[model samples]
Target: MNELISPKYQMKLAADVEKAVWDEFGSYKNVRNYIEKWYEHDEQNYNWENFRVVIRDDKNIDLNATIHSMPGEILLKVAIDLGVDTPDFIPSIPTFKNEIKSEYKTAYDTFTKAYKQIESDPSTAIGLANSALESIIKEILKDKRLKSKIKGNETLYQLSSAILKEFNFSSTEHPKEIKTIGNSLLTANQAIEKLRSEKTNFHGKTNEDFLIEDALYAHFIVNSVATVGLFLNKFYKTKYPKSEPEIEEDDILPF
Candidate 1:
């Protein structure tokens, strides 16, 4: 005697799967629509950057889920065949405006918010600078496929250097300050690093308080990093795509 009923078990499985699919689709309708649009337009053609806008700004969906909802399960199946369960899921696109990515709005928006506090509480400005640094770091790591390496308990200071190492941008290749940037970055990391621990959000704690100059410098360092990082990220991705990292090393870059 099998412990299963024909009509009941079949109905239960079908209903559960249908509900699961419905829930998944409902939660990510914008994503579904974008994916559908891609299919409707040109099944063979797609741009990761434009597609990223949809993911970063609207869907907020992870890469795998987005792949699964791809034009027709083609890319998704290829990924599965490649044994990739968790691929490099890029975060909010850097749109430079409202026409740009929305997730990044928080980081950029902080600059203005911090400016307001510069006169009264410069420490808050430093805090916002720290936040921007954090945002760009996460963005860079996500883009470079190194975010997972930075654990939850890790500090931004830790990631600052680690990101550089992971990016493989040597002193000579560094866009700015070849020799001095490393030590300077180390010191900046140390100083701003404390911002994460010390309670400097409000007006208090003389020892932890930051001055206007410090806040301004903090913004400078972070903004510089973001600018340079975005440049390097885009450059490296084009030069050393995952499919063939050695292609540039063997063919180009030597010149």
Candidate 2:
């Protein structure tokens, strides 16, 4: 007896097929044609707007909770039944579970949204990514009882500085690792600000100026921000109850 492919693998294969069709067609309308090749209804539109309109009518829809996945996996089986060859392409969707503090869950939710929309809506992805980072910083500051020190509304710069400021690492003998991580955080922060101010969905443009490559770069930077934010989240854990916040860079060995 031949072995049957698992359902998860079958879905993965479907995504690969859809990805191939997307790469080849390079247009949503054509992709829709590939999707509904043997459509029963002449009025069936596979456009994103039409899909959204259909999903909106659901009575028990959960909008706040985000599902980190994409569309077009079903197209794979249909294409296969039509004798279309499925290409081997791996999806770059990230899969990770975040068990964060209750106060920080909102930040994590935004992070989830950022990842969910990274490939489709690049501008929204970047904005949500920055918001997640900012939310995490605010949570950290609130935890540390340092919010009182800053008066008035704080910008992303201030939020970033709140984390990077007065850290007991610069003067340390081997602060290279910490320095590198700090620089990554700082670079991501600055890039998020620049990207939001110039491009993102926050402003007037309807993502007309944004491209997929730009979204890819934004995704990379946004993930970089989360990397630093989570590091800070864990780093502050030592000072949760009474202990002072400390820096313990593991790879700080002397030459």
Candidate 3:
């Protein structure tokens, strides 16, 4: 389990672990034994002897280094046991059931897959994040009016551009700040599209091609998908509110 996490992320995770330990157990008193117990019962049967050395000094464990070197799954487990939130780098997907009348199942499923593999399979995660955004855009265009405008084979950026135009997000009639935000979102979508084709495992890579192995890249792409997906869903609802059915009094039974 040679997992190489970003040094900055490792520091944050280490700090959270330290805070959780102090809050729950009141200092590093016998904290090493507590951690050892978890490893002992772990189904994978991790190498406890090596982990023991990492946290040898109960009061002075080099937690940042230990976290950086530990496997991602093990680190998540430790965080769960200590009752801390997952690291901020791991983006969470929102349940969009209430946000929209139609469900974007492909978007949700793909984003979930990306979130789950961010640490162990960064390249695949990046690809999945790109797919997730594409799915969201397709769902938005499912309306008959919007569907007529697209050829159904547009790229991610093209789909995003169509949606933005439909929402009047890119219209010059709006304030400069709003237009700027919309332009930035379009640019970000383009970047994700390029990253997927060139750096991810989505497309077969040649020996000369460079691949993204860092979790940081995957995290950024996945977070972007979540942000863009949420924004699109909210904006779609605002622009095209689902109309409620009219109930006739004559059709209702008297109480």
Candidate 4:
């Protein structure tokens, strides 16, 4: 059997196919149809198992985790590996393709910026990193609530405390930390109540007794805030069309 095509080659093929369909049909529907036909035609000889195989399972792929690899590299690698052919005439691989690229670019840029913040501006980085950790903790809490696993709250709380300390917040050992947690908690009780009423899954177990002690640790370490901030910005802009995104740019390396 032939060796699996490299990701770059796959992308070139996909791009070529897209270009041809665009020249012939000029719309996404037509392009998709052409792709479908191409796939169907090639299915008899094609080996589909090459790219989709889970070579090494990475924990960061989990949805609840706050930090994960930026999607640009993943998509680029997948595209190249799949080697979907695009025709030369297609102007761009349709709006959807552009949108995915744009989203990935934003994520890549944000991570790069956060990394710079850590080296040049520690205080800002701390805030960004802490916020991300807190958000992860909230997500863990929410998931636990849905699963009727609120008994794990103490663990979550301890994890959150440690995460906060890592971001240069107050001491995890202090008694007042509990009070602080109550005050600075990211997810609102009201929202959880609303979810309980509307979402069948939320009502399974409805108590906040447990703390997700290791949640943040499970997701990220030093740059938690920047990661979370990037997510929040993207999510808010997408959800609230009226609000314009505030672009955050840090000092670029002279090189």
lDDT of each: 0.47, 0.55, 0.70, 0.35
Best by lDDT: 3
Compute the lDDT for candidate 4. Answer: 0.35
> Candidate 2: which pairs clash?
none
What's the C-alpha lDDT at position 49 in model 1? Answer: 32
For model 2, how does the per-residue alpha-carbon lDDT over 60-123 read when each residue is reduced to its tens digit? 3221111112224324334433334333311221221153535578876786666656555777
Model 3, span 194-223: residue lDDT tens: 999998878999989999998777767777
Clash pairs, model 3 backbone: none
Cα lDDT of model 1 by residue, 96-169, tens digit = 22221344666566644543444335566667656655665665566545534655455667767776676554
After superposition, candidate 1 runs with Cα above 4 Å error:
1-103, 170-179, 195-199, 202-255
Per-candidate Cα RMSD to the true structure, in Å, reads: 21.0, 14.1, 8.3, 20.4
Sliding window of 10 residues with minimal summed lDDT for model 4: 59-68
Best by TM-score: 3
